[model samples]
Each structure stands twice: as C-alpha cells, then as structure tokens.
Target: MTDKAKKKREPIFSPEDRSNLRWLWLGYLKKRAPWLGAVLLMILIQGLVYQQFLSMTESGLRVIFESGEVGQLVLVCLGVFFLFAVRGLMSYLVPLVTVRLSNEAIFEMRRDLIGHLMSLDLAYFERTKSGEIIHRLVTQTQQLGVFFGLATAGAVRDAVTVVIVSGYLIWKNPILFTTAIVVLPFIIWVMNFVSDRVKQAQGQAERALADYMNGIEETVNGMRTVKIASQEQVEAGRLMKGTGAIRDLMKRVQTTQALVMPSIDLSSAFVYVLVIGGGGYMVLSPDFDVDGAGIITFLLGMVMVFDPARLLAQYFGALQSNLVLLDRVRSLYDEQPSINDAPDAVEDFDTGGDIVLDDVTFSYSEDQPLFEGLDMTFRGGQVSAIVGATGSGKTTILSLLSRLYDVKGGQITIGGQPIETLKVGSLRGAFSVVAQDIVIFNNSIWENIRYVNPEATEEDVWRAAEDAEIADLIRRRGDAPVGPKGAQLSGGQKQRIAIARAFLRDAPILLLDEATSALDQATEERIKAALGRLTKGKTTIVVAHRLSSVADADRIFVLEAGQLVEQGRHDELLETAGLYSQLYQAQKKGYDGR
Candidate 1:
C-alpha cells in the first residue's frame, strides 16, 4: 500500500469491518486446538527434561572434579543419554503436530474466505483488482499456518521453558542468577524495536507483491494486444519494475528480522560476562555457598534458561511481524455484499412475463447520471431491439434489465412485480445473455455447454449445439480443450458456443448485447439465423450497433444518452427521421454492400 493508502486506511477493525479481530482469528484457531495442544505439551515435556539433563551434567562434574566418585559419574552420564533421547523425540514431534495444525487452519480459512468472496456482488469485483483479491485469498490466508506453527505457539511454549529454567538457576545461586539476567530488559527493548520494523516492512512487501502479480496477469491477459502494438518491451519493463520493487521491500523485511538473532546473541554475551566475572569474584571472597563445581552448574543452568529466552525472542519477533496478516485476511472476510436477498425476497417465480423498466434512473457515477425517468416495456413473446451510438447507454440498458446494477430510483419488474422484490437468482435465471465480449472457460466442449446447465443431458447438449450451428465443430474437435478464454477457437465459433449455452438454458427472456457485431457478413448472417430460431416466443432484448441487424424487429427502441428517443418497427423508425434515421443512414453504405 502507498503511504497515503496506509494512512487513509485505518486499522483493520474499521467500521466497515464489523467483526472483532481476536474472535475472528480464534474462530479458526479453536477448531485446530487439539493439534496445537498436542504439540505444545510435547515441547513442554521435552524442555523440562532438557533441564534435568543439565542438572545431571552438574552432578557429574561434581563427582569427577571435587568428590572423585567414579561410579557416581557413570550413573549421571547414563541419565543424561536417556533424557537427551526424550528431548530429541519431542523436538521431532513438535514440528510434526504444528504443521498439521497450521494446515488445518489454512484449509478452513481459505474455504470460508472463498465462499465470502463468491457471495460478494458484481460491484465489489468491479472496484477491487483481481490481483489484490488473489493476494487476499491465496497469499494472505496462508498466514494462518505460520501464525500458529512458528509464531504464537512457539513463543508460548518457549516462554514456559524460559520460566522453568530461570527458576532453577535462581534457586541454585541467586547472586549469579541476578547478574546473568541483567541484560534481559535490553533484550526485550531490542525485540520490540525489531518487531515493529519487521511488521512495517513485511506489510509493504506484501502490498508490492500483489502489484507484481497483477502486472503479470495484465501482461498475460493482453498478450495479443501487446504483440500487435509492439509493446512487448514496455510490458516487460513494467513487470520487471514491479518485481524489483517487491525484492527491495522483502529485503527490508529480512534486514529487520535479521536484527533479532544477533541482538539476542549480543545480550547473551553480556549476561555471560556478568556471570563469569561475578561468580569468580564471589568464590575468591569466600562468601559463595559452593566451590568451582557449583559455579559450573550455575553456568550450565544459565545456558538452559538463556537459550530458550533467545528462542522466545525470535518467535516473539515473528509473531509481531505477521500480526498484520490478521488485518489483511480479516479485511476481506468482513466485506458484506450489500445486494443480498432481502428478508421478504421471493423465488420460485414464473418465467414468462413482460420486462418493464418503469421510471428508472441509474448511473455509474453520481455526477453523470446515465438514466433518469427512463420508462420502457418489452412485451412477452416478442423480439425487441435497442440501438444507440457508443456511450448512449446501450449496454447499460441490458445491465439494468438483468439487475446487474440496481437502478438508483424507480422499479424494474417482471409481470408487474418489482425485480428487487424477487430473489436475485430467480430474477437472473429468467434471462440468457450472449454479449459480443463472451466468456468461455478453459474446458472441453461438452463441459463448456454443460457448465451453463450442469443437469443437461448429453443428448440435450447435442441438440442445443445443432440448434446453435456448432455441432459440426464439436464433432470435429471431439471435446478438445479451448485453452485460455477459448483461444483455440475463432470469434465466430466462440459466439456459437455462447449461443449453444443460451439454447441449452432456454430461459423465458434473452439478452443479446452486440452478439452479431465484429463478424464478417457471412458469419453475421449465419448467427442471425441461429438467433432467429433461439428467440422464438420469448421476451428477447437485443442491443445492436448495426441498424441492419434490428431492421426486422417487432419493435426497435432508439436511445440517446439514456433516454428513449424513438420506438417503432424498422420502416416506421426510418420514416421518423430521428436519431434512429441518422444512425441507420450513417451505416447504410455497408448495409447495402456498397
């Protein structure tokens, strides 16, 4: 995020994000608590045993150096081996269980986030970038895994280890223990400084990474246009710039995290000097309780306590560094789609009815309203065409008819009932859309057609294909892959598949937005013929640019800047010499093959 974006963006718990952050994070963590508990317990037991092993070393040193008890030394050394074995096994089990817990959290977190993303309305997608969404869903959600395995769980268990070992050291020699822990406050201060820097750097790095991903996506999606324009070098440079930015930010994160270990080691070194210098002086003064053997034990115990303290410091740093992930993931999960089903919205509705836009008003921007007091009706069981120049709200009408963007004012209805009152599913289910810009999934022909209606039979698919004039192509291709966005097929062939989907859907209303545009005359006529059979007896709305295509419509509605300027059959519209006549005459030369 830019510095301005970071500033404008308050904390993750903004009013728009209603859920409590702690509760949201704990909700996923609670489900995997058993695995968490199992790992923590294993580490706790191992860590305690490690303390015993250090005590055994102290006893063995006393036996050899002071008392000279050879038999006692043998027994003490054997005890150390078994204790170390338990410690090693525990070290192995901790990671194994932690991984399982992390993955379990990752799976559930991703599942819930994806379902939420899908439930968002079209406007959310329009406003949010695809790469940013992918970052939230894929990259940020994975933070749950690391949050448990390496950060929170490790810090908690290691803190426990530090406490147990520190108590043992203080019990043995309070003077030396006090001297050994004098640097602890400094360690803590260093940790806090490092954690804040790491968190800031990592957050910036992740934002940069999202932009890098979006750059690659744009370059790939528009490769054909890039090649045509000879902008390959430009796109490559842009992508490299994104990658370079991400690299620099990530390096900043690593540099901050690197401060943790070295600061810990330096603090440990200070404690070591204090313990060694103070213990030797106390022994010489004849005021200490024990001899050199006891002093050796004090050093060994300090080793036990300080090492875990070091580990705790590292885990604490990691925990702080990734705290921002909770905000990132929660930001997405809290986005509530405004356009969900109303409390009284009805479904199981009748399919056959006139689509009426009554006193409708809408706009993509408030200052530039597209439609106001717009009123039109397409009678059931008839074909209606909408024609307008570019920017004259041709596609906007189709979007309004389908309720893709709800009108700012007034009501759109089917069978005299407002569409907002009907369930969104039932309302959208009434219309089948085939726009000039069609979407073809990367799948086989059989799968592609069935995707529109999964319950469609193979026989039903074949019949629909034949109706849309795509049967011959499917029979030849034999369900070969369409590659990305149907790159394997021609424009006309892809349009035919979309037509097949509509045919298979066989809804009561049809929406064709420039469906017959950007095609050779031969291909246009063939698709027009298929469209002719497809629209029979249905309330079909067609938005066309070429006047020649809608000349045979039962009604042609001419719109200018979101207002209906004229409405009549083709001969009647041409005779009116209004916007319809002007647009028709502009394209008359090509219409007449001149």
Candidate 2:
C-alpha cells in the first residue's frame, strides 16, 4: 500500500506527535466563531458598563467637591446600580456561551478519537496495551474536556481583558500605559520557559499515572488470582509504589509551574503600584496641573482595567498546564498506521477463499522472529487444520491469512490477488473467525448473534444459533441478563455464542482457534457434527490442540516453532512418521492412558 493509504487507516493520535491537539482545538474554535462573536459583543457591553461605572464614580466625586447636589448624587447612585446589573448579566451570558462552545468541541473530539481507533489495523491493538487504550479513552478524554471548558475559555477571556484593559490604560496615561504593557513580554517569556519544564514533568506524571492505572486494571480483573496466591500485601505495595511515583511527578511539575504565577503577580503588581503612584503624584502636585475630574476618571478606569490584568496573570499560569496536556493528546493523534490497503486496491465481492503464502517472513519486533522462510496454501471448499505447541506461531499463521499485520519480507494472497492489494473492508468481509478466547458483549443472545449480521432478522440469528448448537442455550437465557463481558455465562456458553456469531456471518472463509476447546468432549463432538454441516462448500482453517479435532480434516499441517514441517491427509501424515506422526502417537498414548 502507498504511504498515504496507510496514513488514512492509522489512528488520529499517536504517542510521538503532540501538535494535532492544538489544530483540533483551533478547528473547534473556528466552528464556534459565531458564538465567540456573540461573546465579544457581550464583552463590549461589559466594557461600556465599566466605563459607565467610572463615569458614575467621577460624577459622585464632583457632587462632593464641586456641585454639592444631593439630587445629582442620587442620580449617580442609580446609574451605578443599573451598570452593575448589566455587567452581571453580561458576565453570566459570556460563560454560558463559552461552556456551550467548549462542550461541543469536546464531544466532537471524543467521537473523532473513537472513530479513528476503530479504523486502525488490528495489529495496533495486539501490540498496544489495552489498559493504556482505556486510559486514553476514558481518563485522557476527561482531561481534554477540562482543557476545552476551562483553559480554552480562560485563555480567550484573559486575552480580551488584556486588550480592552490595555486600551483603557493607554487612554489614562500613554507613558504609564507603555510601561505597564512592557511586563507582558516578560510574562510571555517566563511562561514559555516554565512551560517546557512543566511539559517534561507533566509527561512524566502521565506516564506514572498510566502505570498506576495499568496496575488497577490488572488487579481488578485478576483479583481472584491475586487473592488465591496470597500475595495481597506485595500487590498493595506495588500499587502504592506506582501511585507514589505519580504523586511525586505531579508535585515536581506543580511546584516548578507554580513559580510562574507569583513571578507574574509580583511583576504586574509592581507595575500597577508604579502606575498608580505616578498618577497619584501627578494628581496631587499643582506643578503637574492635571484636572481633578480627568484624574479621578482615569484612576477609576485603571481600577476597572487592572482587575482583569491580575486575573490574566493567574490564568496565564493555568495555560501552561493546559499546554502540557494538549501536547500529550496531540502526540497520540499524530501516529501513523504500520499497515494499510492500497488506494487502487480491488474490493473482493466474490471470495472463493483460496489463500497462499509466498516465502513470507514476519516479526512483531525487528529483533524477534515469529516466522522465517514460510510458505503454504489452503484451497477453497476444504477443511485444513494446523497443530502446534504453544508459542510456535500457530495463531500468527491465521493472522497473516487475514492481513492483520503486513508481511515483513514477502507476500500473502487470497483468491489469487495479493491481500495488500485488496481493500481491508473487502478482505475482512470474506472471512469469519472464532478465536480461542471468546469475546461476548453484554447483550442478549439474539443481539450478540446478530452483531455479525446487523441486518439479519430474528429467524436468521436463531438458525445460525441452531447450527452452532447454541439455540437451546439462548432459549434458556431468553429473559436472563448477560452481564458485562458475558460474565453471566459459563465458558462453554460463551464459546457457543461466538460460534453462533460466526455462523450468522456466513463468510466464505472460516478460521477457528480451538473453537470447541472450552466445551466438554460430548459437547465438542456435538458441535463438530454441527460444524460439518455448516462448513461445507467453504475454505476452513482450524488451529487444533487435540489430535481428534483434525482427524477428519481434508489436510493437516504440523508446525513446530513457526516452521511448517508436514502437510497431508491425517492418515498419510501418520504413515510418513514425521512431526505429525509423533504428535498423533503422543495423543494416542494419552487417550490409551485415560
């Protein structure tokens, strides 16, 4: 596949790139630009209200020093009341708009992440830790919400305040205004400097957090095993150590980052005092000769302006932390998928289910080999079985047939076309898999079965279930709730349900990895009989653990440590006295021992 095609199938975020989050946030803001304009209008109204307050205060001062009119004083007081009311209302509305915009952005981000994750190749899931994926989906997504809701709004609001307030400051005294605004550059420099340190520490904190979360997930899922082992204290200590690491990382970041606020605060406050003191001297000294009314108005205006400036300093510190989080999220969004289909790839509409491997070599990692110099073929309308010991790359064979991972050295073909040249959707559509580890969702039997064929009617689902010998079980659970992960069902029941799902799919190719291993011998024999009727006229590959399972297959392939050692009919292989014959002898001995 071409690089562009590969990128299209990749997840939106990756661990290495951290800039996508910034782009996503910018995109979200652009989407809500209209609401932002409305917020700006409200801000303008707020500024006008503050100007009115300055005027009212000045008028009252005049009433005290010059007019001495009680009527004028009452009028100014009335204006103050109305101005405060307008300011309050505008403040309330600005936040409402900000929150609405932020929430919409978060919703879009979450949906995009999920959609991208779904499109990624299955190999990514196999390599990446499930706990980490869950952490990003649930915990990191929540943090993203905080970024949108608090940091995004605060940054914009503080920026607006800085602009409006600085304009008012310039109007008061150009000299003081220039000096006051000078501190902003210093603040920016400090923020940028502090952010790098914060980024490093925050990244460490997130890693530590992931470790702690991983422990929690493992512990929760395997609580029974941990308790049975009587290693609860050791586990608790390990968990505590992880949590402690996270706490320490957070403290380091928070401490160093916290310095930013006080530094900016001291600088802003010094500037504020210098401006106020200079203004006060000018107002008092007759040599300066500034008008009392103008001075009073300017001082009141400065008061109105500086409040936001102080808040800006506070929120500037908050922006640093948000930047760190944004960087982390963006890194994930930027990852490239390792495997993807070609743009001009053929989409398989009629799969005869013929599969071939041509001098293929593969490895999950460069340093570790799973397969080397391997070649095999499975013809259509035949049942082929692969038998091997654990870690002998048995399952890897099935994965390659489906193109779950790209072959490192050679090619895999399905229906005479290179699988990489076929669109992923089309390739997957041709095959149905029943893996050793059965996965059942928290849903009714009918719903789970129909998951493989969403358009299938109840009748179709029941028919498939009957073929899988699971129709009677579903009837038993007609009203029974299947708990999460199918916890309510036994292992055998879950396996049957998975088989039913595959049967309902009715794909031209079927791959089974110990599909009946969870069932008792009697149930396995029963299901095998049913499968005989179901798998007719289709290509089938079964990874067998028991010799009995593959005795009836058209062909049996023996693998030991990724090498294909034998391939033939069961009886023919036994007569050859190769790896297959040794396996058969061992199984026969075990059966006779029983």
Who wins the lDDT comparison?
Answer: 1
Question: What do the candidate models score in CA lDDT, each in turn?
Answer: 0.81, 0.77
lDDT of 1 by residue, 407-443 (tens): 8998888888888888888888888988888888898
lDDT tens per residue, model 2, 86-108: 88998788788777777778778
Q: State each model's C-alpha RMSD to the native.
A: 3.5, 6.3
Model 2: lDDT to the true structure: 0.77
True lDDT of residue 441, candidate 1: 88
Candidate 2 error regions (>4 Å):
1-22, 174-193, 264-280, 290-303, 479-481
Per-candidate TM vs. native?
0.93, 0.89
TM-score of 1: 0.93
